[model samples]
Target chain A: MVIPITTGKGRSSRMHEFWEALTDPHVDFLRIALLMGLLASLAFGMTGSLVVVKRISYVAGAISHAVLGGIGAALYLQTVHGLEWMHPLLGALLAALLAAVIIAWIRNNGFQREDSVIGAVWAGGMATGLVFISKTPGFVDPMSYLFGNILILSRTDLYLVSILDLLLLGILFVQYNRLQALCFDEEQARLRGIRVGWYYTLLLCLIACTVVLLVSVVGIVLVVALLTIPAAMAGQHVRSLGAMMALSSLLTLFFVSLGIVIGFLGDWPAGPAIILVAGVAYLLQSLLKRVAA
Target chain B: MSEPAVIDCTEITVRYGPVTVLDKVSFVVPERRTLCIVGPNGGGKSTLLKVLLGLVRPQSGTVRVLGREPRQARMRVGYMPQYVQIDPLFPIDVEGIVRMGRLKGRGLGFYTREDRMATRQALEEVGLWEQRREAYINLSGGMKQRVLIARALVNNPELLLLDEPTAMVDAHIEARLLEKLKELHNRMTILLVSHDATFVSGLVDEVLCVNRTAEIHPVERVRDKSVTRLYGEPVQHVVHGHTHHHGEGEEQPDA
Candidate 1:
């Protein structure tokens, strides 16, 4: 039940009902959304910061969109052949990783322009997914994949997100300094004996996995906005990458939590609401800075 | 016994698609000696530096640095690129940029005490210690070049490679930087690419004039005529009063 605002005794009762709805163990949807929001902040904060700083948001967008191909393939196999072990998320991870590798290779080795390569993969991936989904012989809501319904998340999705989040966090923690060098000057990073090629590939691969995990929360279409907006805001005010990451994560938490609550109350899509909140926050921050100046 | 050449390249040729950048070029820098590579834009000066760094593989060449392939000796070589293209909005301070030099040997760990000390000494040497906490992207162009120099210096490399270190600095700062390089030259081998022929004349032991091909000339032999020959056009040397000043005296080539 959506909470209703009132000025009298009815307000108090509605507040109690809202609290009960959140606390009720049987109504796990809100709890899942809350957990997803927290995890999204932690994951996107780090990933988004790197994505923006390295100027690879376009690459990330390509990988994220490419995951749908895998999702569709997995669904087709599972539904048609009764392959119970083939999870859609697994398919998505593989698809994203493959797309990241291909995109990076094209950007590095191909003489052609990078945007053209990314553009081709971007549309090709979605078309591939659509073709597979159409042939699945049953009613599968594309909205769930294209525009994520966080309220419908299963425990499995949370597990997948958590495992991937830990992997991302672990990789970042281990290679923080190397990443800093890579981000600063890749040529110098190479002279410093850091394998620039390997690290770049690893980073893109990590982005691929991160995109796959985020698809269930923000969907494929809005994930880039969710990934970049908070981190971009934090980058303006912070002096170190570590500080930027911490601040971005906190901002993500604020935007995601507020957006989830607003979406629940106002009956709107949570992902778009979260991105809208972040965009508005960024605008407000810029305006405040301009005014102060 | 004399030390082997720090850098030894024999018949090096580099090509990018249809264009041949460095055509069958050869040069060597003796140990503890400084060499200045003079050439016009797109004359493969930067490409030469990349080859030495093993960043660019030559189409045909044999390159040896400190008795090994350039790639093998890359860890022991400190390279400062021509242009510092770091985004102005990047969130990195001076100390952080300087600390990146120490990231060579260590893998996936925090900076060590030695790393910190090296960063401090490098920053202090460049007179940027007070501004160590300042953002690198906000620094003046000269200051930014010095910061990059400090990054190169932090590693205590056997061979220091600088690409147009003085290109962005003013005349006064260029003079000071030259003095610093003179002092630094006594300790390690330096190979720098410069657009200004006269800036490093007194400082460099020898001059390697690079066009599409290459030639090693004695400091005295590198006159205004040589620069005209190098760029294939009369050079309007900026900053210095002399039209072509290749270090005041006649220092004979030992190449």
Candidate 2:
């Protein structure tokens, strides 16, 4: 595997004509972005498996949309409060988790009519964030939020993402059995004294954390697809409810990485192209599962 | 053995939208006792059991099991769902399904040896210990019912709620299942829901009749008129040694 590095490698590799040949900033940015697209898909796929096992596609989508508000919160904090302590992903995650808690509370409290409220929040969040973005001075470009500046993945970004991913995987593994039970039957889960509300909240937090990296890498536009398709496809193929997750994470990495390479060669937009790759994989897996059965 | 009320339901009422399935019903299922919910089709038998297990909440009622709410009491409770409508090809093995009963804790972890032992004991109790390795789909109807019971029993529940446990079984196997239930009732509290009023009446200490309303009847006098009063049924049940038979004009009984 080619290990990712920064700084001295570029400077030292300048002597080699082939490595030095691509001097265009646009091409270099795009090249890095292709890799970022793959990483985004991996994050999305892992989170998707979480969504699938929890049967929370609607919740995930609602949470993803809620991230828009999180982004706005981060912006507001940084600008108004002059707090450099905020990161975009962290802010978004906090907001999304809050939304999850609210949704679960509403559902448990018999406020069945409030599901539509999530949709309203979705629109309102994006609109609020967009308006904030427009009013910000010297912001230059907001393309990073809509599409992505994946080409700008510094070494620090990769390291941060790697740590986050490990933490996510660790949390999932530690509570593996509980996740399986929660996936199968919530009633049974609660009977086992699994605080259904709290676990649900934790799941939302994990999903939000996962989505933060996904949004950062691939932008919000393509993140939802990456979060849903692979896990869904994996669920249909795997025998046990738990195995579906392992398969999903693997499938997610494969398609997204593959898509990035394809987009790289084709001079295409990496985020959307990578997500399409996952879609195609899902279609193929469906066909295969059908044939096997 | 200490005799506690494994399932205690009082003034429980269940409604499905506009249709009220069970009206204010009360019962105390003492440990080592068998209580059956017997009535015609569309009677509130299943709903009553569900309420007792906290699977379905009653609109206005008080329910308790082992001195706790049904939902909280569920850990010590085992359930055998009806086999009539389920597809055979549910993609689980007989023993695997049984294992689910024991490993149902909130935490994430591998099942322990104790869980495996429970599965073995439950299978043996149901007489399918020999066929423990069989695919659930490959089993006959009676065998499937036994397997379902085994699944519930594996949890070593203090209370067992059997919803139409023998509905799809053959007559001979139904009798055999009855024997197994009799043996199980010597240890845990058992509640079975079925339209086979006379049959269940012979097996249990008491019969709880449920239609739109619930009426408790002792085993000695659960005749057709009592059945009709609770369920408005035209059918008649003749009690045999332990089996209940509907007359020729009676519609097909669903469990």
Top TM-score: which candidate number?
Answer: 1
- DockQ result, candidate 2: 0.31
Separate DockQ for every predicted complex: 0.60, 0.31
Candidate 2 runs further than 4 Å off? A1-46, A76-84, A138-143, A147-150, A289-293, B1-24, B39-47, B54-73, B82-100, B103-110, B123-148, B164-186, B195-205, B233-255
Residue A195, candidate 2: alpha-carbon lDDT: 70
Error of 2 at A193 (Å): 2.3
TM match of model 2 to true structure: 0.77
* Whole-model lDDT, model 1: 0.83
Q: How high a TM-score does candidate 1 get?
A: 0.91
Candidate 1 residue pairs that clash: B201-B247, B202-B247
Over A147-179, each residue of candidate 1 has an lDDT whose tens digit, in order, gives 676777878878887887899889888898888
Best candidate according to lDDT: 1
Least accurate stretch of 10 residues (summed lDDT) in model 2 chain A? Answer: A1-10
